[model samples]
Target: MLKQLSVAVLTAAGLLLPAAADASPARFLDQSTIPDLQRAMDRRQLTSEQLTRGYLRRIEELNPRLHAVVQTNPDALAAAKESDTRRRTHSSRSPLEGIPVLLKENTDTADRQTTTAGSTAMLGSRPAKDAFLVQRLRSAGAVVLGKANLSEWSNFRSTAQIPGWSGVAGQTRNPYALDRSPCGSSSGSAVAAAAGLATVAIGTETDGSIVCPAAATSTVGVKTSLGVVSRGGVVPITAQHDTPGPIARNVTDAALTLSVLAGADPADPASAAATFPKDLRLDRNALRGKRIGVWRKGHTGIDQQSDRIFESTVHTLRSLGATVVDGADVEDISWSVKPDLLPALLTEFKHDLNAYLAATPGDHPRNLSELIAYNDQHRDVEMPLFDQNLFVEANATDGNLNDQAYRRHRAAATGIAQRSIDDVLASNGLDAIVTLSGLPASPLDRPGDPRFLSSTRNTSVAGYPNITVPAGFAGPLPVGISFLGTKYHDAQLLSFAYAYEQATHARQAPRYLPAATG
Candidate 1:
């Protein structure tokens, strides 16, 4: 399966690239920001077709080892040509114009690429239209570079599963360390962004999917408040928490991408009430007077090096003229216990996934029960690493949002999560809460669940915005610090993260080390 996928990806790359004699200079592609690329294009030094081909070549070169991209868009070069024509006509749309962006495989696109969600059960499934966010990207003149691999079913299929493994794409390796997990559902998005396979990528989070992978891969990820970016046409884990956001090598790119993606969508009811700032440009001085809260208890304590890095990060914040409030942990909370979250998520998954699959075009599983049965029938490929226990559990639910027990759990879980973040911020008088995004990426061969130290739960359950930026390194692996804020604070969080990122300049491109060293 892995060999066949690689052959398909390589063939796609071959089709996109120009012949060697006709190739353009692409040495400037590495670590190039959106503004930098735009400036280069403005100077007549580069074109969108060249940039797109450069990325396609990189994907072909690296994806054999990283498994980051599952498919490259057949229309990518044509889209780039269109962007070039628009630019020559002085009608460029947005900051993202001509940027090549990867979509996580779960994000539906009405094109040749399949929206499989990294599962063979949906191997040939197609969507009737572009996902709402994809529509926005196209409107902004961004090229849909390709579809990235992800944890199968967005990591909802099995509790025992590896973070970046999927039936279709195999495993996605961290760019920094091939032996380490990418900490995903958004695994490929983060890896591709970090490795410069694309200008940026879109990822969905239902808890730590976005931020966790961003931290692991040493990239920037913004988990916009739920509904800030519509979930329509994306594979659903649960509408209550799932949100599509940008993962990029820098905050400016992520923020710019978010500006394009954020808007109310009629197809997604959750987006109806959401609002966003007209401009999301970053302010380098945004953190000067901000009061940032530090939740020491949120530290995972598994990596002493990460703990030291967090302390250093706090000092850096203070040096940036920010007031640092220590020990601002969420009060009176069962930080270790989450009794209601599971039942609520399971029920919603059954209901929401059924709806999404039923609407998807092509012949495939149309409901949760059908998906489970398909897995059973193809156990060799789908269950090679882990069983679909979560699917079974979700299918056992009443699968109705109106069920009294489901409603109770949903309300209680969301309420507790909201209060946890809101009360802490209010008590501390904070602009944002800061903590380690999680422990550095764990080795893939280690048994049991990976130890994650992030405060992802509080923000995720409350449907708030969370941004993770590269803080520093723990040995050869990178660690990230998170800036989390209440709902609709997406722009503010971006500003804070941007300031910190500029001040520190801590992110380093991956060396693709075989393993980490102490």
Candidate 2:
């Protein structure tokens, strides 16, 4: 009875705000999309400052409970004012002119906000400038609302670490059920988007960081093809695997955000040889006559709840004119048999991170060893839940790229992953592969016991493109279906995902409920 009363009280307090209030035509900012907001602004029914203030109000009301937003941009309103000025002058930059977007804490912005990756050791560390992607987002007129909390050090601190619990910001709860985990290292970004705290958010992925969190939170996540999005100012995990991508509540929004974020960067040599799409649009009939491979090889350990959604998704695609092939397996891919991923990441992390630190303008720890030492010195705060074993391991390793063993492992893994994906696509004449992105959010008490199979390994290792769209729910929690394609096939992948999303509008706004009753 007390629990029921508590829930009623919370709901009455406007925790589960509606999409539209019957008393006024002012649509809920949480329910408004980038284009929708722009239309409202153009119609004179809304202004950039008004929209920004609405979002800020929502953040102030819910952030304390969700812990999704680590900080709110103090200048968000001012930036929105500038956007309003641009609109008055007919000098709007892009479609994102007044849209507010949240960024993962690891993404460096040369503003007052700190880019700490949710670690105390790098709390006050400031970069001289915004990350290459941030520069593009700003140029396109998207306001950097603030940094979202992430798994400390992008979940690389320890093998037993919690996904969303950062040393600096604590744990970000699942907005749908506050007790459930918001998977990371993109936890806060996923939660923020799911809760409608931002128009869209950016999350960086070395592996499952972007997709896993989006799936868990019922948001759309686009893990772009390696080199499609520049990683110039993003804190390092592994340059070979790390790429910043978009997380949003729908496929179109994610696609729109990606359009702004994707491009070549001379500073990021990995993207130097990459191709960016000249045009991207949603075609509802995109799945018509397209052959998509169902990657059964990657479906191990999928829970019954998610499998049910996956089956329904397959039927939905078939109904929409897609030829779905089940039991499609990749040939010559030995990801499970190989131990090359961690080794490669360790090598690159030690080298890439130190280089970034050396370039950063701050008095913080400048190397992995110093970072490790800082954590030890601040053990109660930083290492309360998990130790820095991964840091120690990376620090001890000789990670020189010139080393013969390092080169061998990197080449071998990259080659195996790439060949496996290419061979499967060619053999099946498949445009893309579909699989369960992840299962529902798990309870935070046992953070290590993840319930679903992650589709991150193959795509991350192969440096290919993958996108996740909400498929359905496991009770109150969400499950996502992933669409993956060959390298530089981001457009095709997005089209496929967008088509599925249109066919099955599975995403729903989070309710900020206290817990999952089921």
| Top-lDDT candidate index | 1
Q: What overall lDDT goes with each candidate model? A: 0.86, 0.83
Model 1 compared with the native: what TM-score?
A: 0.93
Which runs in model 2 stand beyond 4 Å of their true positions? 1-30, 297-302, 330-337, 447-452
Q: RMSD in angstroms, all models?
A: 5.5, 5.0
For model 2, residues 126-243, the per-residue Cα lDDT tens digits are 8999999999999998888988999998998898889899988999999878989898899999998988788899999988899999998999898988999999999988989998
Model 1 lDDT per residue over 1-518, tens place: 22332333344543233212122222234445789878766655567887788788888888898999999999999999999999999899999999999999999999988999999999879799999999999999999999999999999999888888989999999988899989898999999998878999999999889999999888999998989999988999999999999999899889889999999999888899998886766898998999999987747466788889898899999998899998787543345326788988999999999999888889899899999999999999999889999999999998889988878888898898888899889988999989888887879877423454446878888899999999999888999999998989889999999999999988987878888876
Candidate 1: worst-modelled 10 consecutive residues by lDDT: 18-27
Q: What TM-score, computed on C-alpha atoms, does each candidate reach?
A: 0.93, 0.93
- Per-residue error at 427 for model 2, in Å? 0.8
